[model samples]
Target chain A: MPSDLPHSHGRRQFLKLGSSGLAVALIPVSAFAETDDMLAAQAELFGDRPVQTGRVSVDLPPIAENGFSVPINIQVDSPMTEDDYVSQIVILSPRNPLPVLAQYHLTPRNGLAAVSARIRLGGTQSIRVIAEMNDGTLWSGEKETLVTLAACVVL
Target chain B: MTTIRLSVPDTAERDEIIQIRAMIQHDMESGFRVGARGEFLPRDIITRFECFYNGDQVFAADFHPGVAANPFLEFHVRATDSGSFEFVWTDQHGEVWTDTASIQVS
Candidate 1:
């Protein structure tokens, strides 16, 4: 009976170890890892051009009660004239499953380089908006939102 | 056929800045969800939206899955002339939904 008890104890231990290993693999990777991948994908679109951090303003609540529909407004201080205007505006959410949320293409016909929409966020993360001027200059703005409830959770 | 709604001032002063709003009805399936039977749902979303004023593009957007369903967009456009504003939305399947609104400028 004593020899049989030892064999049962060893089997139990092996099962426990296997279950723990599976748990670790099931856990999602840290948000930072996802952000790095998103950044690399962004670089492919805009190149390694230095992103100037001004001339654009991002408006959003500091704390979002719901991540499913967070209202966002972006405004660029451009005159929207033929000589100088914003050609493109991009919104990126690093933590979201798809980082590039929206890309807006504007022309001088748009009297203002401003847009407003509702976007989804996976969690507390930084939202970046980049404005590309017709002169080939890029300007960006960033805002952080603490999401109490995440939207894109895998069931 | 999908129902589309567009909001623009029927009349405006010349060169006045007018707000343009458009909404389309569609499910923006993010392609990340699994069905009850454990089958992956393919992504189907409106990938592009374009607004043309008097045959010239005034604004456009490239949308991803992060955007919510029934996409709504608001932006500013200079009312230069009284012409038809054409709005077009293209989905992943190459299907296009279009609507037009006319504006009068004094």
Candidate 2:
């Protein structure tokens, strides 16, 4: 049946449908899925507000030799002016017993929305950072670290 | 008693962004471990930290077990005036440790 669509239209549809169908049939549990604690923490922090993933950078080593002390740095792209500024930054760990790794409150006086510090990881997992602006917008970024030695979770 | 080490430029130009680093001796007990008797240890980590430039709060952090022991933090601020920078830390046991450093801003 010849249609107005391009020749690759049918192939594109087939590929999309085939992959989605295979996903439903084969992968019942995906590691990419967010944990309940992570979801709840995000919900509590964002409160149904959309969190766009950009303008935030999370820098951590790809492989941490020890989970007890890993240096991490986070920066948010902001002018840090009086009218517009980054209000808060939160770090959450899904694998940790307590999802909250740390919370930082910033203001225009800070002149920059950046911080560096050392953190502990319970295991190899992704660490998420959320930045809230003074205008009520939220942006986020994440970094994954593989820890050779896992540490105890924070209860 | 916690030994607090703070570093800040002794002098800075007006409106220049100044970098500050602070470290303290802390065990940062996670309370996730058990003793020989199998009872969970009580949390003994720093609960809060705040940095004040002159007198206004410039930066602050709320800690959790995920922060490594002997907490070290580095942040920045714009020098608006010649004054002192004060760092305060409060632990889970309601103990507070504070240190101050002076900065000469031109």
Candidate 3:
């Protein structure tokens, strides 16, 4: 699939290294003042590919009375073998100050590419999941949720 | 750090579903207001959590700052075995906290 941003797609090839090492490229909040640069950086690392629709499933409660700890589950259909497998899974919150919340790297030894966790949301927004196959194919899924009580502020 | 409680059902009437409940104590700071003269409090939020059963992770999520303080989550597990389950939580500051609970089969 073709990437929406051509320049950003090329940057992803430079990042096929260690998954943990990619965290170093994440821009800090201070840099958010330059939203354009931040977007460019994010697109380079994340948006460079066309994410196939409906390849992954994300499950969450429809109405989260509280936001501090909302349950979430993600599962991808893959054989997960030594030769072909899911390399990474990324969770994105569109409205959060930092959209990229978590990234999980899996090897064939992991047995399954499914994960369940609790997440904090600032408000009601859409949560997006992007799954990257070992071959650089990106698949996406999204869900919109309503949160009653939000957390994560310094008061 | 607030106390956390987790419970797994003792037995399941069916083969596909098992109930699990989890609770944590915390005053999720919203970072919206200040104390006395307006001293901005520190932000202490759990950003992500995962559940591992028998070394295989069955659930995981990425949390944001908007979640309320002291969250409780409940869900079902596809009854596989009466093994141990582990929950790992990571706060906004990148600190990791973990708890373990075991399930018994009838």
lDDT of prediction 3: 0.68
Error of 1 at A74 (Å): 0.7
lDDT tens readout by residue for model 1, A47-138 = 99888999999998999898878889999999999999999999987888778999999999898999998888889888999899999889
Clashes of 3: 24
How would you encode candidate 3's per-residue C-alpha lDDT over A53-73 as one tens digit per residue? 887999989998776577888
- Which residue pairs in model 2 clash with each other? none
> DockQ values for all predictions?
0.59, 0.53, 0.22
Q: What's the CA error at residue A64 for candidate 3, in Å?
A: 1.4
Candidate 3 lDDT over B1-106, as tens digits, reads 5598888766644344565667677665655547788786666767677778789876665544444456555544566677788988877778777899877654
- Steric clash pairs (candidate 1): none
Q: What number of backbone clashes does candidate 2 have, counting pairs of residues 3 or more apart or in separate chains?
A: 0
i-RMSD of model 1 (Å, 1 decimal): 1.3
Q: Write the per-residue lDDT of candidate 1 for residues B1-106, one digit (tens) a residue.
A: 7889999999999999999999999888888778889887899999999999999988999999888788999999999899899999999999999999999999
Summarize candidate 2's per-residue lDDT along A79-109 as a digit string, tens digits.
9999999999999987777788899999899
- Where does candidate 1 chain A have its weakest 10-residue lDDT segment? A24-33
